[model samples]
Target: MTAAASSAGIRLRDHPAFILFWISRVCSALAFQMLGVVVGWLVYSLTGSAAALGLVGLAQFLPILCLTLLVGHVADTFDRRRIVLACQTLSALTVGALALAEGSGHAGLLPIYAAVVTIGASRAFEAPTMAALLPRLVPGEVLPRALAVASSAMQMATIAGPAVGGFAYIFGPAVPLTLAAVCYGVAAVAMAFIRHVHAPGPRSAMTLETLLSGLAFIRRSPVVLGSISLDLFAVLLGGVTALLPIYAGEILHVGTQGLGALRAAPAVGAVLMSIVLVRRPPTRQVGHVMFAAVAVFGLATVVFSLSSSFLLSLGALFVLGAADNVSVVIRSSLVQLSTPDEMRGRVSAVNSLFVGTSNQLGEFESGMVAALIGAVGAGVVGGVGTLMVVALWTRLFPALFHVDAMPVKVETRR
Candidate 1:
């Protein structure tokens, strides 16, 4: 497709490959979100400990932290689609195992943690491989729209998955987990239907140098570094997702249904923001917009921390999600547009590591702090920390702050 043809109003839907890819993404996202809700609720209900909840996050994060570099190399050196299929298959089996264990009334914290670790290992490979596959599905000009569409689909699933999981939990904890396994199974089948082919790049001998190349590239690219690190520290400190169960049960005086609403609220806001971006994609002052969005996100987090009313907290989370979607779109576009195609997998792996840190490790941090300061104090402090991260990052990375447009020329090795 020519650049002009690709730009003529949301032509991503015209591509079969993208459609299949989008379906796979939505299915996987829905399953993952549901799994998160089920796991958080189950573990907390079983153990009644905030630290146990943090440990769950840690279990999921450890594999990604340890294997991401090797996974990045594999993505650049192999068929990304096949890699995704294999990982999804593994994830399906893991979730299925959890469902069986739970259904048998023999589920323990250890078994659940083991299952989470397996899922994390699968995601370690899948995240980078899936990211690398996107460029093959559509032309560069259409990428932004494709990404927005894909994100919207994923967000829509996220908005529904938690509520579904919450209600399904009333049936049995195993019910939601069983459904999550089915979603992963469907995603694997969707992967099988995708026809895009990516020939492996030149294989270099396995070495420390080859594995660390993605990190080196990011360090040299100031814009990518700044954008990623900004997300890293901001979300790392500001994330209060880990404490939601505590808030829903103890503070808000709501049950499982309300917990589902709390989890789904952010995605609702994100879906709305994504739809708006699909209509009018940001083309100028991208950096400024990203900063402002994150600031708003921090502000929303603060509001959520202080609000005792369930409705008010939901509203705060909604605004938080919307602000975050803006930052995600802008940062994702910049990252993809700036990196060389040959190194996209590696760079994307680095991006995944940042995401894992911000999310999983951030969850751990929230739980730890909440254990010390209480959930409300943890949220307030995290929100303030997010705002502080923004100010520090802006002063430190001036290039990121002034970035005006998505640079057409990809950055090359210096």
Candidate 2:
């Protein structure tokens, strides 16, 4: 590592609160990832129906879609630390219940689906609350590096979580679920250790205005709107997650094992890019950097779609992941830094809504498109669409695209 990067790491290590938060985040993320792999495998094994697997994702997402406004309100009104702890505990219990059901031979499709929806609901609460708390744990100047370091949970979860769960599944499906429950438990405990638990400031009652405040806050800020929406439209249009199985099975002709590698490739790229950001956090022209990253994301998708060779496809996925990591780090830092302590939860919930929905919706979009044209054609179309979003977003949210520095903080209007 360069001396400067090494120096940055040491400074970050000085904050004990961030350390605890990071630990909790890693544990929580790992639990979620483990649960995901096992659930998919178990569902597919039980039903052997592709549509059933699709329903599993839909089941998880529906709660988030339904609960977005309420979840954000609760986060803003209550103690974020306790909120996160409670949600993690709930996840542990719900997943544990699923594991017990499996062991007892009562783990039917309905039981699994029920547990997934409950877990999803808890996550909808956990994610935004966690995000709202991060800015409080570190100083404004270091927030970018802090965000980069925190992205490690995503990187670790993306790469290691499934791999660990898959290995544990060799013992039995229940094993991974059991491990996931344990991880959640650990996450809850770690969250409890955070020193400064924020109590939200005095606010208006839970009225229609209060509920819609988050969306309003976002809409008023062109930068926030642009960054968040850019991610939504870009990923919603560009993501090829739903097409991976098809590629592994038919297009790439690599089979299930190949699918595993393909799934991990983007994450691997993300991890590498995150490390670079931690070492040398973006300081200027971040707007340009993010747009470029999104463009690369699009270009890589296009290349991957056109590639016939498996090795070339993997390389394309690697580039795609790396580009995604850059844009995500920049966007996340910008959002948290710009939002106020009081309104962070609400705004973050809206952000979460876009991010959370976009993944599944993107898959759904990709699947629908592929059904009509084919996987390769669908990918190419999605990539081009992402590039078009970049062009249009630059024109629409000029402040974000031309920004030289991310906002340090903003006071929300009540």
Candidate whose lDDT is highest: 2
TM-score of each: 0.88, 0.95
**Candidate 1 structure quality by residue, lDDT tens digits, 1-414:** 223224546454567787778778888888998999899998999999988987887888899999888898898887789999999999999999999999999899888888888998998898778887886777666666667777787788877887788789999999999999999999999999998567777888879998899899899998989988999988999888888999899999999889878988898998888777777777788899999999999999999999899999999999999999989888887887777776878889989999987887788899899999999999999999999988988899999998887664533323
Give candidate 1 regions above 4 Å deviation: 1-8, 39-53, 97-111, 170-174, 245-258, 368-377, 408-414
TM-score of 2: 0.95
* 8-85 per-residue lDDT for model 2 (tens digits): 763534777787788899999998899989999999999999889989888888888999999889888888899999
State the C-alpha lDDT per candidate.
0.85, 0.88
Report the Cα lDDT for residue 391, model 2: 97
lDDT for model 2, please: 0.88
Question: Would you list the clashing residue pairs of candidate 2?
Answer: none
Q: Report the C-alpha displacement of residue 157, candidate 1, in angstroms.
A: 2.8
